[model samples]
Target: MNKQEIGTFLLRVMLGFTFLMHGLSKFQGGLGNISGWFQSIGIPGFMAYVVGTIELVGGIALIFGLGTRIISVLLIFIMAGAILYVKLPAGFMGNGEGTGFELDLVLMIIALHLGLNGSSFLSIDSKLPNRKRGQVSDKMAS
Candidate 1:
């Protein structure tokens, strides 16, 4: 296997898994509490469900490399929303009661990379029928 492809696959899978867990957590027991928190923060409570759904579906898409580019873009927006609407006020390092946007930033950067570079040859994106050779590839060239 191409090493660059391997690296890209690793990155995508890890990112996907992280989002999946986060989304799953939102539904596991805390969705209502999280929704209430969202409303308390001035956001509509329904947004919690929307965000949770996107994170859950997008996470799965990324994991399978099924919709890497689109999912990555969506994830970027989610991260931006998290940073601007929630984490920014917490301070860069974090507050006594809450964490900060640093993690969101990192996740966004990774999504950005995947958005720009696409999933590599190891991904389902590459193996899909009707895809042109080299149409989807990572730029790492590792």
Candidate 2:
């Protein structure tokens, strides 16, 4: 495909894979432990499971380019929440004492780009009949 298409595909794959791993790690480490951590941070403990499941499912959808815009938006919310609640106070460098929002912000930007652009290439959205070969597609709108 073209460079832009390849780039978008790569971004989708990377974001999906990263989140998939994170979700898997949370499961492997025990949901209770993750829930406890969330509770400690003032978030409801049950939200840990909900967020983990969403990340896992959303990551798969992203890799396959299914519901890309919606998935991107959901993932964006997760990243934004992370930045606002956990990382923003730590500053840019992360300094070992606490993590920083820099990574979360980068992920949020990528998610926002995908949300606005839709799944440009190598995606199920593009393969659907509603999307024309050369037209600008708002997959969700269609």
Candidate 3:
């Protein structure tokens, strides 16, 4: 419940919701187009499914504070790919050819922070009755 915890929770929720929406959009708006776009970008079409699943699942997990660090790591990889493959060519401001990598960079940084620090006491990981070593919880933090 400290400032850092509150900030982390906000970041976690924000990043999670963002990924959730993107993942949901990929499916709701039709993965066929996403798959085609991936293929066009030189990535395997099937990776669309993999990325979508990870985003959706990872988003939910992050929101609930379950496996926060692991999920954050996965999200970091996704953002990296996005920046490297798609957004970099678009320039920092998009330059009129799709969106830029700024947001991706931000998200990647958030994920990096989560991966390094883990989640707050409000997380399920923290609430677990018996936690493994290295896991941070309210009591453990105290």
lDDT (tens digit, per residue) of candidate 2 on 1-142: 7888789889998898888888888888999999999999999999899889878888888998988899899999999888877887788768688988888888889999899988658788778777556777676558
**CA lDDT of each candidate?**
0.87, 0.86, 0.91
Q: Which candidate number has the best lDDT?
A: 3
Instruction: List where candidate 2 sits over 4 angstroms from the true fold.
Output: 131-142
Residue-by-residue lDDT tens digits, candidate 3, 16-117:
999999999889978888999999999999999989988998898899999999999999999999999999988887988699999999999999999999
TM-score (C-alpha, index-matched) for candidate 3: 0.88
* Candidate 1 off by > 4 Å: 130-142
Q: TM-scores, in order shown?
A: 0.84, 0.86, 0.88
lDDT value, residue 34 of candidate 3: 93
Judging by TM-score, tell me the better candidate of 1 and 2: 2
Q: By descending lDDT, how would the candidates be arranged?
A: 3, 1, 2
